[model samples]
Target: MKIFTARLRQTQFEISAANLAQCPPEQGVEIAFAGRSNSGKSSALNTLVDHGGLARTSKTPGRTQLINFFRMDDNCKLVDLPGYGYAKVPEKMKLEWQAHMGEYLEQRQCLAGLILVMDVRHPLKDFDRMMLEWSQHQNMPVHILLSKSDKLKRGPAKNSVLGVRKEIKAYGDQVTAQLFSSHNKEGVEQAREVLANWFGFEKEYETAQ
Candidate 1:
């Protein structure tokens, strides 16, 4: 299918929500990107949309402590969820963030799919497994991006992807994975194809011959 990647460049920041109550109206499809702190989530998102400053990357681990939404169109959006695990925040604040994220995951009706980003060097930590289990329970489709692939040699990066696939096989075909590099733009098109498919844009274009 031909997914117009150019349209993704049009994505603009819509709003930020500190809690579930602060989110916009739930009327459209939302694809959320979730990962632990310093997992390169923001970089991956910025690269995917071909925009340098769309998702707001930072040197600090816990800088993105709110739910940031980017509107792709009238009925489509990309959500950057608060980073979890190892953010230098206080225990009480971390707990509050976790509660908010949990509520957003469990209660959001418009969430079409999840793009779980993980650092290739540190794949599938406790946070990642928790998300996998939750998505499995909810029967939600998840596409895992082994981000920062450029940091590793090709052999190890490919192995990481293979290992993750084997580990998540029990969760069924709804869960998929791929190696990605925001720095080098490796696998950007592949990642975008997954987004296009999940966003239902594949139906809007004719299949490639």
Candidate 2:
């Protein structure tokens, strides 16, 4: 497998719908991450690129309100979507976010796949399950990344991964599952391998392609 040399070249952020609306259309392979608030999504992104603080890491939930795009290379983009499950936000705002995210996922033409990050301890919550269903319905490739696996014992991490994979298989075969831990650097290479496969993929995908 090829190791991405330029992991992440730069990162920029926003906090508004209008700003996200202005995003440059994806011209190359794009892998986006979506997950619940405080789920260590940012940490996992940092781990993928071996760069801390490129995307803000925080204890506060729902800090990211816009679709943040990080440039990985000239041909690809690593997307960090806003976290859901925010309670302090207003009800109307929540509805708008739902619509916004739905629209983006439903129609993002260059999106090669989605990396759904979840806390290994928590695995798939209610919202995560729904997103799984959504991806299944769209026939999009979805990788369930069990993030923060360092919190679990080794045996527990393996069990958590197996359980998540089993449950997601019920949803569809489009799902691929793996364990991850930013602290331990577990699954970093695995994630990269999967993304590279997708990035280089063409229609009627086969490993040969």
Candidate 3:
């Protein structure tokens, strides 16, 4: 399958939204990347786009505090959502972030799908389940990335993928998953294929082939 070799390479940071009203115009398709803090969400995004600094990677968890938008083209965009389930922040601030996230997920008209990143060793945390349930309720499709797979043995990494696939089966076929490791470029093509399909770029990729 074709990777994000063309269109996605053009992604550029567009806006950062702290609340729903601050979001850009609700136009075109957008797929959101979300996971718990320190789950390697930003790294996975940079890997997918083949841009080292496209999405900032921080050593501190919960550094991405706003909903950041990246424009791929006129018809497609990618959203880097604030990570959930970090305790370093104030409870009130966490609650406010949760509220804004909920509002965006439930009310965003342009959302086409969700990319749920999870650390390979700790897949499916409580917040991950909550996100899956919410997406299922919204009838939105989800693609899960088991990030940081390079830290695990091959057998364990495969097992983790299987375990997550089984766990997410309750949400139906709308939720699909694969192993990923930004450090070693593992599963980058597979993740890109999913994103391309979600954004209706499969035909373009096929045509290019």
Q: Which stretches of candidate 2 lie over 4 Å from their true place?
A: 1-20, 201-209
Question: Which runs in model 3 stand beyond 4 Å of their true positions?
Answer: 1-4, 204-209
As for candidate 2, its clashing pairs are none
Q: Candidate 1: lDDT over CA atoms?
A: 0.92
Lowest lDDT 10-residue stretch of candidate 3: 1-10
Candidate 2 residue-wise lDDT, 25-143, digit = tens: 65877788899987888888877777788777677888777777777666777778778897997888777777788878888888878899998888789989889888888888998
Provide the lDDT at 103 for model 1.
Answer: 97
Residues 1-209, candidate 3: write the lDDT tens digits.
Answer: 43456778889999999999999998889999999988999999999998989887799999888999999988899999998888888899899999999999999999999999999999999999999999999999999999999999999999999999998899999999999999999999888888888887877767888
Considering TM-score, where higher is better, how would the candidates rank from best to worst? 1, 3, 2
Q: For model 2, state the Cα shift of residue 113 in Å.
A: 0.4
Task: For model 3, name the residue pairs that clash.
Answer: none
**RMSD of each predicted structure:** 1.9, 3.3, 1.7
Better of 1 and 2 by lDDT: 1
Candidate 1 lDDT over residue span 90-117, tens digit each:
9998999999999999999999999999
- Give the CA lDDT, 0 to 100, for residue 161 in model 2: 91
Candidate that beats the other on TM-score, 2 or 3, i.e. the better one: 3
**RMSD (CA, angstroms), candidate 2:** 3.3
